[model samples]
Target: MSAHAMKMLNTLLPALVAVFSASTFAGEAQIELKEGAGRDTVMANCAMCHSIDYIQMNSLFMKRTDWQATVDKMVNVMGAPISQDDISVILDYLTTYYGVE
Candidate 1:
């Protein structure tokens, strides 16, 4: 192959690799939750102590008060140490999307 052609191939190869890598990472940036999947943040933050599925499934049948109580327990009893902003987001998600239906 010509020297110029080899040089072009090397440059193009790196560009192609970078493009593909960026595209792959774009898809993996973050998992976007639906309106009701607010508990996802909770799971991400609180799952250190237990299974996230346990929280997800249980929240499905809870009332707003139940959710508040559960959040309180996680903060006060379990000592999950979540931020107030995150706590509000999680509680809103549970009450709006995961509450008893």
Candidate 2:
């Protein structure tokens, strides 16, 4: 190859490797949520906007009211298309499985 071609390959190769490596790592970093009655609904709805890992991260301190407020914010403020029925199930699951006192 020409020297110019070699130099371009050297410049782009690291960037290409980094991009692929990051994507591979991200794909493998999924959070497996605890199984529950509303697990499927929460997975389907919540993951539409943010990582489901947020639930696990906050479970240590979140209460029923906190989950309710968060869901309200998601619906009223963020325009998440969660049906009323799904909201009830999701709240129940979150509060029962993840809530604190």
Candidate 3:
């Protein structure tokens, strides 16, 4: 290749590699929620907006009330597109499985 072309490639190659490399965040994980009846509802609706790991992260400290407030925020403020029936089921699943004792 011409020297000019080689120079352009060297300039752009590192940026291209950085942009395309999967290893940067490849270790990102998904949450494995506790299995139950409403688990599917929660996964279906909640995961549409954010990762299940969001719930798993909060499951460490959040309680039933906290989950309730979170759901309220998602629905009322963030517009998560949850239905009334799905809301009830998702709340139940999150509280029962992820809530702190």
lDDT of 3 by residue, 1-101 (tens): 99999999999999989876655335334337789989889878987887687888898999888998999999999988999999889878988888898
Q: For every model in order, what is the number of clashing pairs?
A: 0, 0, 0
After superposition on all C-alphas, the RMSD of every candidate to the true structure, in Å, is 10.8, 5.6, 5.7
lDDT of 1: 0.74
lDDT of candidates 1 onward, in order: 0.74, 0.92, 0.85
lDDT of each residue in 1-101, candidate 1, tens digit only: 99999999998999999999898667545533444555567667666676455555776679988988988998899898888889888888877866785
**Leading candidate by lDDT:** 2
Assess the local accuracy of residue 71 in candidate 2 as a C-alpha lDDT between 0 and 100: 98
What TM-scores do the predictions have? 0.55, 0.73, 0.72
Candidate 3 residue 78 C-alpha distance from true site, Å: 0.7
Comparison by TM-score, 2 against 3, better one: 2
lDDT of 2 by residue, 1-101 (tens): 99999999999999999999898659648778789799999989998888777888899999999999999999999999999999999999999999998
Clashing pairs in 3: none
